[model samples]
Target: MLDQTIKVELSTTKKQKPNADQLQFGKIFTDHMFIMDYTEGKGWHDPRIVPYQPITLDPSSVVFHYGQTVFEGLKAYVTKEGKVQLFRPEKNMERLNQSNDRMVIPKIDEQFALKALKQLVSIDKDWIPTAEGTSLYIRPFIIATQPFLGVAPSSQYKFMIIMSPVGAYYKEGLNPVKILVENEYVRTVKGGTGTAKTGGNYAASLKAQEISSQKGYSQVLWLDGIEHKYVEEVGSMNIFFKIDGKVVTPELSGSILPGITRDSIIQLLKYWNIPVEERKISIEEIYEAYDKGLLEEAFGTGTAAVISPVGELLWKDRKIVLNNGETGPLSKKLYDTLTGIQYGTVEDPFGWIVTVE
Candidate 1:
């Protein structure tokens, strides 16, 4: 429906696709990619699909200097019936626009972007992996292209969609991970670019993540930037805790990224009539609950790892283990139900699945 004029050029020499069993995350790309350009006066134009290759940009591109970039990630699953489907892709597009607004980039038409995604996926549909715990990872991003040296918004930009066949995020697959509570380095602050899905945030987290990795931790549990007391997120994922028969997650207070998976799990919890609350949850409170024997379970949710159970939290030499460092019942159930709906094995009561064909 987007002008019906997108020019697509299939790749003549297709690259050898990776086997599903040996697939890694974001390493193997499909044969083709979707691209669109934008100018200051003339909005977004020249929608096209071409062979996947390197892009040429000037050395003075704003994206390289000022870091004006925003991206979104979603996956396309292959059902048992050999059908391709996207999970709440519109939500990703909506979030991308929100990021664009914050990054000073031009907003793209969501419907058009979705159509482009479907067309691109259809062209490389054979690249979709059907093996267990494997799906096609879709990355849609926008970058400032104006080759200007001044510190201002770019007048030119490029929007692109690329696909990769990826296996599970963790090699262990749905197992609990050890997280180090980060009280020193902060991921983001209030009135900052915390909610936006931009590159600078991830760039800023690399140091803490590297340190935590050296310390034998999977990820860093970031506390609030102001006082470094309240919980914000765990690595790149939003976190949740089960305490005394209730589910609690950090409320969206303009600093945390409103995760789609986080929202879905909250909805699922409420539908099951479980006591769920979205409010400020401090790390000390979680420690207090653990001290009082009320801490039931802990997990993190995101696009990559659907639900990653937190087995241990190490804060200042104090270690709090959840569920005996094993995956909890609630964590397992959520992962199973969400993945079942994604793979078309369970009935989609909430109408969250969208078929490609």
Candidate 2:
């Protein structure tokens, strides 16, 4: 219905090019945007692509104080043949709806939302970067807009999608990241909104992330809130430890965000006949494996970094370096296979990429 029905608002901008190498992440915006509004009675409506401009929200808006916001991060890439493709966007829409269902926000049709996004991309296809590892980063978010001070979910909301041209996660090359062991500052706990892609979770994490950054750590590896023994995740990304020739990651404990990249990696591992396990993994176990030289490699997976190799883990004063701060064999193999599939360089055995044009 959306594909043939609506005429997109084309608010073009004078193409002012930036130094591709100097592009800071999320610092610039494209010309146009995709927007849709939702009210109490009228569900999602007014879906359109407008000029990128400041959106007005009252200071007392619910999202300002209550933080009832949810978002999804994904990317669209134009292939070497100038064909635009999205990387399994249905997964993002499903996750976005799951976020809506949990937040009590009005559920809109996912197919329609996708159609709107594809049309927006088609209009702004020229903004997509043609450089290596660059992409059109898509951010779809919903925020509570009602002006009530009460504690309940707002009756009004806005669902909007924006695009930004982004350089690769590792512009300095594929370098290993140093993760700090955060004994405190638990990311999400049991019976909490950890599974939801809400803003509060991220807002709660910024302080810890800032502290870690100041202390020369690239990210933080969160521990289980109750015992602080089990490994949870790293920053916003999930962790995978290659132990004993098998892949082991933390099981979904109701506190961990089920990262789309993490799920995809597990599937690809299994498809390649590599041993993979999803279960409880403790800090002690990982440390022991590393000490015994059995820990082949450790990396965090997500949409942002895609795959970040961990060179050293900083637990207070202890520094556990993984073989001289270089990417491991398994890490390279996984990165190559996944990125190859994404960039249309490898055989997409599972048919994950969706062509946009």
Candidate 3:
């Protein structure tokens, strides 16, 4: 059920207006935050909008030991009307519930979360950046709190929503990035917690990403565990390939995450009459198509980055260049269209825009 006792206490940095340019991707925090706690029998309570501060926890907390936790990411924007808006927060709420189901985190009312978050944002609206490609990043996470030595899920949990100001994914501009195809390590496997937005998945991919970065690549193109031929994803984002004039992406196979940006791209492309296909994309097909000049485009989609074009992919000693080392026409079209809708320039016929005011 939705927690009704809404507490309020503004942060000490309650300024009239924060310098928008000071945001350096989560370096600055907002004046308020949302927090709630849950226990096995008591459920979720103490829904509050309080000052942003550090959270104290027991050293033996289950989350500290076994790492039974889950989290979500979403953003809030400031429209030209000087009012705040969120892009389909209900979807994030549902995704959080799905994560709870997978990790055994207790479920709280989504409406209550929406209410509490809105209150915090309303109180700290000045933190929202007005610059292009800038936003107020919202992160909601739940961690096990009960101190237990057993290897089981904790009975107590803490859910929190912290906000930070972020700038464009690429500070200079939207430049195409090179990706490394990592065949050595698998990010997630079938029947694993790949579909959920839990920390372990990201942790497993960190080593691979670090290796790729150390070798001069921006991200890694992961493959399925069993065959290692099917393309899975790119870092934390979903992958897409435009082959033979048809856009193809790996279908969600329980090991793949269904990103909001990926879904939005599919919908927008279909609306524009673009042939977007969702199927199992094989690495062999991509490499062969690159040789045949059929692979027109490739990109990664996620919340942090709306669309990151893949200019080159290094698989072992062989390098595959996508469409001659630049962003494809279709990739740019989708990026502009999606961003246009988000910034309220074009029509939002799908009813995806949810105004915060």
Tens-place lDDT per residue, model 1, 113-152, is 9999999999999999888878999999999999999999
RMSD of 1: 1.0
Model 1 vs. true fold: TM: 0.98
TM-score of 2: 0.96
Best by TM-score: 1
Q: How well is each residue in 1-357 modelled by candidate 2, as lDDT tens digits?
A: 344354476675555745667566677877878888888887777777887778999888899888888999998887888889888898999999988888888876889889888888888888888888888888999999998899998989998888888888787668899999898788889888888899988988998999999999989999988999999999999999998899999999899998999999999999989999999999989888988988888999999878999999987678898857788887888887887788888888888998886
TM-score of each: 0.98, 0.96, 0.96
lDDT of 2: 0.86
| RMSD, candidate 3, Å | 1.5
For candidate 3, the per-residue lDDT at 271 reads 87
Question: Which candidate gets the maximum lDDT versus the true structure?
Answer: 1
- Stretches of candidate 3 above 4 Å error? 15-22
Clashes of each: 0, 0, 0
What is the alpha-carbon lDDT for the whole of candidate 1? 0.94
Candidate 3, residue 85: how far the Cα is off, in Å: 1.5
Give the Å error, residue 357, model 2: 1.8
Q: Model 2, which residues run further than 4 Å from truth?
A: 1-4
State each model's CA lDDT, in order. 0.94, 0.86, 0.86
